[model samples]
Target: MSKKVLVTGADGFIGSHLVEELILQGYDVKAFCYYNSFNSWGWLDSFPKSLLDKIEIFTGDVRDPNGVRTAMKGCDMVFHLAALIAIPYSYHSPDSYVDTNIKGTLNIIQAAKDLEIERVLVTSTSEIYGTAQYVPIDEKHPKQPQSPYSASKIGADCMADSFYRSFDMPITIVRPFNTYGPRQSARAIIPTIISQLLNGYEEIKLGDLTPTRDLLFVKDTVKGFIEISKSNFLIGHECNIATNSEISMQKMADTLIHLINPSAKIIQDTDRLRPEKSEVFRLFGDNKKIIEHTNWKVEHTLEQGLQATIDWFSEAENLKQYKAGIYNV
Candidate 1:
């Protein structure tokens, strides 16, 4: 029988894409979506009915241990992607980030230990490394929690590691740096720019264009997750899914404006700027660990990924989902 996998946060941007890809690969998939009043499945609701039919949707909050346990009951593997990821929002309400990111992850691994689940991949972020004391940051780099969101993720990562060291649980912390693609939240830099330009804003609003990032296309990041899961060598270790390159916000904005609207210009938005100390100025990740362990490689270049994202946002149906006129966080 094909392995049944439970993907927590499967209703989210990266999570939805992961679910679609997993189903296409013939895994019996259970999508653990955050429960909601409108019965909305986040981006998963936008998926074609044919693909939607193939998934087992489990509606529950990851913060609840009982709910997480119930969701993992029949699954052979677990991909815990549920977390409050917005940095600005975390600043406003860090308690929620703690309850969800740290505690939610604890629930998953704690249950996994009891259930004897074969594998557990806890999703992590590149922000944990802060400004990158060294270029091309590897898994061994000291985790500098720059924001409450990153701090919560750091706590969560530690919790997973404790479970691994104490009980020998099969766990791997999969960290992806600056993933961008279709269905990304407008809170992110790429989507914020794309949404405004497509919506006919001549002067695009932005903040902190000097910061550089190692952008990985969402599909490439997803491929990293799958390939890493296939490797027994990665258990109890952390791996970064990255392109091993870097780009500045200014250059990235120029490219997007060139692609969508040449007439557009960047307009500084004070509200969008991160606090001086909190902002992560640079993030260039080391991908050697994942490369050494798995067959994954970058299938999308920066241009290819940006074009794909722009193409998706240009569509009337997709573009309408984002409100470019207001700040997302």
Candidate 2:
């Protein structure tokens, strides 16, 4: 029998891609999405009918322990990816970040412990490392939370660590750098850039052009998750899925603009700028740990990833979903 896996936040950008990959790998998937009044499944609604038929959709908030526990029942493995991830939104509502990111992760750990799940993978972000203290940050790098979103993730990582130390639970925190690809919302940098250019916006509004990021394609990130799950040697550890590369926001925008529209100009929108102290100036990740432990490799180059993202957003139907005129969050 195929191992039954439950993926929380399965309706989100990275979550949806992870779910699709899981299904293709022949895993019996239970997709846990945030419950909504309109019965919306977010990006999962875009999946083909045949693919959707294979997934067990469970709609419930991660903040609810009972709901999380119920979703984990009968599942052999759990992938906890549900969290409020927007940095700007975190500044406006830090309480929600604590409740959802930290508390939600706690609920997953508790349930996974109680249920004796074979493996539990907690999704983390490169944002937790804050500005790079050194080039090519490794797992040993000091965590500096510059934003509330990163702060909450740091707390959650600590909680996951506590569970591993106290109960000897099988858990692995898989941290991926900036993952960009299709079905991504406009809130992300790549989507924001592509959406505006695709909508015929000659002037793109952006913020913090100097800040750098270690960009990883969505497929590479998904492969990291799967490789980590299958590796028994990685229990109770944290691993980073990255390309060991860095790209400044301005350079990234230039690259995207060159690919989509050479005439487009970037304008610094004051409203889009992150608070100076809260901004993470650099994020150059080190992929040594994940590479040494797992059979995972970066199959997509940065150019390949960006071109794919641009192609997806250029489609008339996909481009229309985003309001390119407004600053998202």
Per-prediction tally of clashes: 0, 0
lDDT of 1 by residue, 80-106 (tens): 999999999999999999999999999
Q: Model 2, which residues run further than 4 Å from truth? A: none
Poorly placed runs, candidate 1 (over 4 Å): none
- lDDT tens digits, residues 208-327, model 2? 899999998999999899999999989989999999999998999999999989999999999999989899999999999899988999999999999888888778888888998888
Local error of candidate 1 at 101, Å?
Answer: 0.4
> How far is 127's C-alpha from truth in model 2 (Å)?
0.8
* TM-score per model over all chains: 0.99, 0.99
Cα RMSD of all models vs. native, in order, equals 0.6, 0.7
Q: lDDT of model 1 at residue 245?
A: 93
Error of 2 at 21 (Å): 0.6
